[model samples]
Target: MGRSSLLKRIFALNVAAFVLAGLVLAFTPATVSAEIARLEAAVLVLVLAATAAIDFLLLRRALAPLRRLSGLMETVEPLHPGQRLPEEDSSPEEIRRLAVAFNGMLARLEEERRRSVERSLGAQEAERLRVAQELHDGIGQSLTALMLQIDRAARRVPQENPLQGELCGAREAARTLLGEVREVATRLRPEALDDLGLANALEALCARVGDQSGIPVRLSVDPGLPPLSPEAELVVFRIAQEALSNTLRHADASAAELTLAVGDDGTVTLRAADDGRGLGDSVPGAGIQGMHERALLLGGTCQLRTLPAGGTEVALRLRTAEVVA
Candidate 1:
């Protein structure tokens, strides 16, 4: 027979041994014609029953944990760090060991996940800091000096007729640089975010973007929405910031809309839509990925897609466990 069949036969033999032990007690000299036979038969029957019971119990004690453990492994959800192997009070050493192994595996996986998240956030922060430094040092300082030079040149515009056009272009360029510096710094962290409330900060941001990009941005906020925690506020603001930036960068949109609202049922929603060129087949950058990760960390869902007419829209929902700061 095949190996599986052989094992099955062995299992059958073990069961038969237990049955034979019982049969030996029931049909011995105890159950025959002698007057003493009835009493002996009763006693033997009891002994055989006990022997059968002991064998089954011992086998069960040895194999029960393994059987349950097999089922546990199959049911295990490895993706969820919160999930774990079963812990039983009276399981055998082998079973306990299996559970221990599973728990250890989950613990290690969870630690790795935490480190990965931290590393990602750290990278984003570093980028922000880098961009901030770039703007402040390279762009901001240069724009300041250029503005001074433009002012000096403009004063001489009365005398230098030929230099008027050149001065106008220089002045425009200086202003553009100054605006670009502010935009870069805004992307890293808003000036008002730390000092002012979230609502005011968002309003200021939307207005500034609209003015700079030459795209009319409309913000609609529902009065019912409660004040969010700093962390949640920061997340929402950043997502909106990226979405608007994308519209300005890729959509070539003439107009964009932003909305923040909360329902009585405790639902919070953020939406940003634009009427620009729709999404094309292109890989998302680290900025987009960072926003997605931020939403995910808050147990929120983020959706970015091309609208039917044209342009892209972003929608997001935050979970209750999310802390603002």
Candidate 2:
């Protein structure tokens, strides 16, 4: 036989209770005549009211767990997982089973979301690598050849010739353009991360940001940190980059600090703080949301908050054990 549903159980309980009450009344000496006395009528009304109050209390108690679960569902955020309903021993079987099923569903959804983000970000990184290579190998080489030709032509011209000045200027412009292209390529795909490792890459990033933005940036990397997968490393770097970029663009800050450290339990943390006007009532923009999404892909968390004293802080935490690798 199929298991009884909550509604059916409730209906059965109410029907049995009413039938027992009727049997007790029929077996008792109490009788209802065509015209009843005022005291008897009052007593009947009180009995009916008492029975209704008991039924209401029983129904509320049975549905309380479901109501609590509904409230949790309403408040749960899709981007930030981990919310779950409590499955208490005292709860009805139906409610407990529902809680278990809902929790399982949340886990599956979170895993699917993580996978989707991984594929999307992986594709993005691949594209960046391709574009960076093209800029460095193709246009960059052409610019280099152009600069050489300009230099040779300027050398051939007489020192006093007006055209020599134009050639020199042209060469200088080409050199500047080449430098810019290289910088863009570096930004698109950081070679230092592949060559020098995460620590050095972060140090170079801080230096470059400070040079470009005219803001001092300090970096500290813990010694002998635990190893992180390439994806995890990239996520951390990107979050740091976005945090610094936001500070440079909107914080109006003069200085910033970036730190990488491993916790006692082997959790890796990346934090960036800026000494600037804090975000006050401003909603998180795309960059901030991107940082959060990147963290989620690594099964990590990214938190952005304004410091009490001044400025803003972006903190990213990843558990080494939970990382998907």
Candidate 3:
């Protein structure tokens, strides 16, 4: 029976016990005679008092768990996903039900917290990408021009002189600096994605990822896949980039595959699959989360799962936006 029904029954029983005590006091005429009357009266009072006390104790026992439940609930903070009601194994059925509901609420809260974190991380990456693009378009180009100018000027400086050796060293150092800047800029944002379309950019990214990481990348893009909007292309590029990065950082897999496709109705998909150890629910990296938010923002989904054949697979699917001039 429910706790409320049980308490109702207890209330009815108490009322019946009091009514019976009153009947004994009024209806027993022979027992009410003088000395016998006093003894009966005393017995009736004691019995009634004992029954009332028992009822009070029973009600207290039943309600004690609820009091504890209230205390736990008061301590719970809605914003704090980790805070939860304490387990109450010995609690009454209603108290236990309340505890179960409270824990379920906490679980949902934790899920929301994770999503919020994912969105924040995605925003950060997007900001980094914007900065990278600015550097590539402005600062990086200027540096290249500066290097060329310096090289031309060095050639004009008299040949076969002592300063020529020092100038050669300086020129070499400038070249090194130029390469380093380009590399850093690429790490922040791939210029290929901006200059070239999605397909060609991804091919270059995969080739370099394989060469640098020593993890062979097998890429297969659909030949007939239609061109996607720049926004959609950027998302695909970022997903592939982060997924390959995961393989390099976390996946012990010797190889990975990147697959891209486009549907007639304009659905674009990118998949990065690797044969490496899977990171369970406790993925500490912001990459997976960033990919998820990017997917969500573009009316799509991103999934990270352990491949059935023993690897980690990250996939992104998005509705392609109409291309604009």
TM-score top scorer: 2
**Backbone clashes, each candidate:** 6, 0, 0
| lDDT tens digits by residue: candidate 2, 83-107 | 7778766666797788889889999
Write down the lDDT that model 1 would get: 0.75
Per-residue CA lDDT of candidate 1, range 127-179, in tens? 88788878878889888998888889788778558787788888888898798
- Prediction 3 TM-score vs. true: 0.56
Clashing pairs for predicted structure model 2, backbone only: none
Predict model 2's lDDT versus the native.
Answer: 0.86
Badly placed stretches (over 4 Å) of model 3 are 1-126, 137-142, 262-267, 280-284, 319-325
Give all candidates' CA lDDT scores.
0.75, 0.86, 0.75
Better candidate number, 1 or 2, judged by lDDT: 2
What is model 1's C-alpha RMSD?
A: 10.0
**Sort order, TM-score high to low:** 2, 1, 3
